[model samples]
Target: MIWSSSRPQLGFKRVAVVLLVAPIVALAPLDPVQAQQIPSSSVNAAELISSLKETTLQSGLTVAATTVRTVETTTNLNLRSSPSSSSKKLAVMPKGTELSVSATHAGWSQVRYGGKTGWASNDYLRTVAKAIRAGELGKTTAELKLRQNANTVSKVLTTVPKAGIFTVKRISGGFAQIIRRGKTGWVQSKYLSTVAQKPGREIYIDQKYTSNRAGLTDIYWTRVSGGDLRESVNGKILIGDIPRNSVVYRDLKLEKTAGSVSGWIFVHTQGMTGWMKTSQMSRKSTATTKPSKYTAKQVLAQTNGKVPEKMLAAIAWDPEKTLIASPALKDLNRLNAAFKKKFGKNIDIDLAYRTRATQDAYWIKLGPYVAARPGTSNHGWGTAIDMPETYDYSFRGKYFKWLKANSKNYNWVHRKILEEESPYAEAWHFDYVGR
Candidate 1:
């Protein structure tokens, strides 16, 4: 169901109506106080189901038979009311103490303890329940190996040692489902104590966009300009007056003859919808990328190979142009490779190599060119790339935020933004200082 911000009370009323209208199956009675406390009216089950089916195969569904699933002391562990620590804390579960699994909500699995049923943050859980197997080893799958050490490597399928015994839940591909501690993930099927067969279905949401905030009704029912809502396969269209990153759930009707069933769609910021064939949405969590195939030497050589002359010329004559350098064809190549490694794509270099004559002219026309200023500009060398702010200006955009988080690993620094008395907050400027 879609939630509207305007009558929050009305939203509650609708939920109540849906609950009353929905057939009351023989499911466990949920704690109403716990359900009412969280504001998740925006979530749509249709969309969530669609998202889930696309990524992973469906598994059997069952309600929690117990109040909470406790992680007793193997060590001193934190116990929070919600799955996130940002929520409230009830108490820390001492060694050998029991904790209750209150509810499975969002990414967190809620637990109850100490006369309170709050959330225990899921971050500390070392294992995940669902994971696909990678390859077969003996009777079991091989232990899963991570490309890098990160939290994202949670549910990988891999081979386990033969002597190690694990409680097998199921088998998918070459992996075995096993519970390690209290968490579940894929292990080698050969290492499992036993295997069980289960039937399941996968579901996912058909979102219209990649960004969460576009094409949703929570902010408004119609476009601000009061026009009929029209969607296009190519042209950019503004959704209703929704926030920039809001996500929406839409139900689609498909042709039965075509073997297509109607489902929900998720909208992103770019006015595009992400379509899903399945019925469940997985929580957003970090996942590690495969290590780059390119060696560091190869990356450096490619970066130093060529600079886009036209891009540099565009920024050369700018009124605020401070310093400019002749494009180092090789350095530009290395920069591109480095960026792609970190961001999974090429770095957009607004300014490449510039001629000294053009630099001088700009300096004379304006004041001291940023590059000509003493002891300041990395542009003096050929290792800098200036990103354009707009199509025409030298400002930054969403891409800049990505650079800030990752550029350092590649020896790139955003010189202008780091300056205390910089002329402008130019987010697109980057310089490669050798690591």
Candidate 2:
């Protein structure tokens, strides 16, 4: 049964009345006169006026009908008459005490225990659904490293072989601290599983994009001129050419700059792990742009300098109007597709892929404060674009909201909003940050 408590009011009330009346008033049948007698104060006013804050038996307190176990196994939890620790102590509750929570306030929970109504700290409480305790057996799915601490960078004490079962001591930060062959240490949480449940799926280091379950759902079909499944990332050892419509896993980390196109993503189907060009991949690919090598000073001096032939050749122009880095073009195209689908039109782009001279000219006109100093501009990297004719944050239309929710999947981000105290706060400026 779902247990709900009346929204408590912040007003002066006796502590005894608050403890006894609140829970009963919540379940009591009410008539018009009773309903009128029940206090209903504005929540906004209570929150705004801190001094007026008070918890009453029949007001402001919420309770749950379900029983929960205490997580603290070694020590007793102090039960208080009121929510505050400074309040009078009612009893000392032993570890693993099952409590039926009637209401919760701040960090304290009001529970019914041994025919007594009192409050206990919420920190040591856990629901029955997740009641795993220390010394329980668990197994690691893959060859996992046991570390000194919960963090990934912690020193490795030893390695747990694939499917190695161990006794769990505790869990923190998604890592399980366990005892294996009398040795206690921490291992990556995703790899650990309960005894009955099998270990997590194996994930190779190079296959960084395949770890998250959310990413697995985003499967895209192949749309390549000629697609081949290779054994390695460079695709030097070609296994064989797969059919054009084969489903491939998009590894976000493997997407790198290759010639004019930046959409070379590491993909795998069955046992074939290989690199595939963005053009060869159908649907959306989570590819991002690599940072430009030219610094502000470099760009100023290299106005006449040529962009690398490999990079220059990869530049893809959409309908001959907008020029973007070949690697980022797919994302840009995807963004446009989404924008068109939602708003019945494409986003109007005013500029993309600026030359050093063009950037220097903008710097001269807008100055460093209003614009990025020459080479540092994202536009020069061919991974940024200016939407509409001008940048304006004040325009909060449906188009802007759509862009906010959808742009990141394509690696596009509004720099001004993401960065703090940003000198370049253009509302219309979006840069690819996937790299």
Candidate 3:
């Protein structure tokens, strides 16, 4: 949700209620025994002691300024006895119910309603401004058009109900951009009041991932024979190398698709600050370094040289009578040459560098489990080759053995991971690591 990052915690004390409809009536004098409790040396000794205690309590306690806010949850939010879901629920606050927050916790807010106090989930609380001047508050005088733009000709996004309090941010001619519902929008300035307003409480936005333990702990360094650091999850940009035996932080802020848990994460090493793939990191901090010469640029150079300028691809071709096509030009050609030396026939292809449109079609047809989203697949990058869908049975015996033994020389490697671990798990699937 779009919101401020965090709201400062506030505290408020219970306030006594009083009515002013009747004339003042003095109370009877205290009982003789009650008055006798005071020391003879100090006529107001009891009162003085009570006053000192109250002063100490007030000094030690923090009082939050009175501010109003509203509930923005689609459904009513439960008000609990404590700041946790397990706490006994005291009430339910409905959507648009304006209330005053007395305090705030990590994900909960304490509020008093209907003469009772309870904690509510801060996830649904949207701060509202009261009347004030300067960075002050204003109330809508009438139903005013909240436009998408500053001008009256702009589309009316919604209507601000009469007497609705808003935090005015800026004024452009007749329209004002106000903060409401944890978001900023435009409203008419004439319909808002500049009367003195109560102090507004701060409310923070939730930007963290759903995973609770995300980014909390660091994965210890182990023998690092990891992978490449990418600019983003499944992105092509290579920022730095995540050496073996280094600290790697695992967090949920990175994108996590169903097939891959490895997402781009923040890494600070060798004075560089960029993101890297999580697969390249381990929990162990020390191990013998075995650097692989394989690099993405090497493959890019070969593919780019084969394709036209401004193109990030190579022509996908079918080597044999097989219906499958492959985008890895040099590697595919080498594999076919080696195959001819062993089985005297070409290896068939099942798929290759699919266009964005084609990939989207597969994503729609096969779903996320069976297909990678468009632009994120290695096939689209021209680095992966899928053998015939039935290559497991088609390339049997001698052909299979030769491929297993010789494919590595051409930089092809089969991945062994759970279907949930990677996008797909096909025995015929091979990626060109490097020569």
Candidate 4:
């Protein structure tokens, strides 16, 4: 400390300066806002495009804004350099003009205009929203069958194969809720078509009706009474009191002959009386009537000369009017002859040749009639006859009974009788179907 130099030392001065600068040094923290403001070098073109694609896929926003890639026009149109007409026209883009995109300059885009690739206005060309791909739309398929349970062994709702198409309303997990043939049901989404959805209206089957006690009545019936059958009311046939809607099959005809009311047997459901219309009845497509495969000579031989020529002529003219064929008529003639031989007289015919319309009307009046019932009736076959009281008094009593018992031999069968549960007690009713 006491040492001193006569001359100034430059090296010592530089050393003093370095020592002072070293003491002033210290570390300071950076400002958060300033750091955030700095530009990042990480973002690039590929990253932006990838992010946009991923977002679109996840959000299900498949729609996009689209520009006209090509403008096809029938006539020559002006392509303005600007979006407005006041702007200069780049050129006249005639029909079949093709333009390549130069750039999307502003609200007005720049596309190759006229012959050159200079900027043409975008104001004229309309913009349209993009549509979803065909693969993305819902598809529909027809239902082959309806199962009561998930198991394949479940009960079937329909016997015949019914047709129905299903619309894929929604899809979730592995199951899809679809409107199958108008009914909503669940099906595997994989079963549906992956292509475009079908578009059309659906069709359905008609409703069915069932049988009843007071006679046939569909869901449409509101009232029914015993007096509905005119013949039964006139014949005074006492059809046992039947509860409404109770199903009854007609088996025999109950009629009053000569003031004697009795039941006469027919085919299936023998001694069956009356018919009921039910909600189970369904509409049939067609009904056909054919003549019996017997010749006139065979018919005459079978009847043993009992049937009248006039009746035969009538039947021949309209075989369908009565479900009787020549063979059936032949049998009825034989039965009629036998009855004549036993009872000593020809039986009278009450009603004959009832058109389908008339039969349907009668049923409707009676408040319900089932079409297909067991046992064949003469009225149904058409070769039969109904002996209503309005026809003749001889049609009632023992004559009618004797005829009923021996009529089958001659091929005659009683049509609608109270015993058959038929609304009408046709004492003289007879059919020609051979037993």
Model number with the top lDDT: 2
Q: Using TM-score as the measure, name the better of candidate 3 and candidate 4.
A: 3
Choose 2 or 3, whichever is better by lDDT. 2
lDDT per residue as tens, model 1, 98-216: 44455654444555555566654333332322232321111233434311112334544343343333334446654455544334565544233221211000011251112222223
Worst 10 residues of 1 by lDDT: 1-10
Best by TM-score: 2
Model 3 spans with C-alpha error above 4 angstroms: 1-328, 391-398, 418-423
* Model 2 regions more than 4 Å off: 1-306, 309-320, 390-394, 416-423
All candidates' TM-scores? 0.23, 0.28, 0.27, 0.24
- Per-residue C-alpha lDDT of model 2 across residues 1-435, encoded as one tens digit per residue: 000111111222223323333343343221111224445442223222321333333254655535443232122455678665456766655545565567677656787655678876665565432323343445556999888898899888888787665556677767788755445788876675544311111123343322222234445655542365544545464434433344566655444423223556666542234566666776632222332443333333332312332232121222223445545656677788887787777677645555554445435433433345667766665667765422222134455556766798888987554321221223456877654
- In order, the Cα lDDT scores of the candidates are 0.35, 0.50, 0.46, 0.35
The stretch of ten residues in a row with the least summed lDDT in candidate 3 is 1-10
**Cα lDDT for residue 324, model 1?**
22
**Model 2 scores what on Cα lDDT?**
0.50
Q: For candidate 2, what is the TM-score?
A: 0.28
What TM-score does prediction 4 earn? 0.24
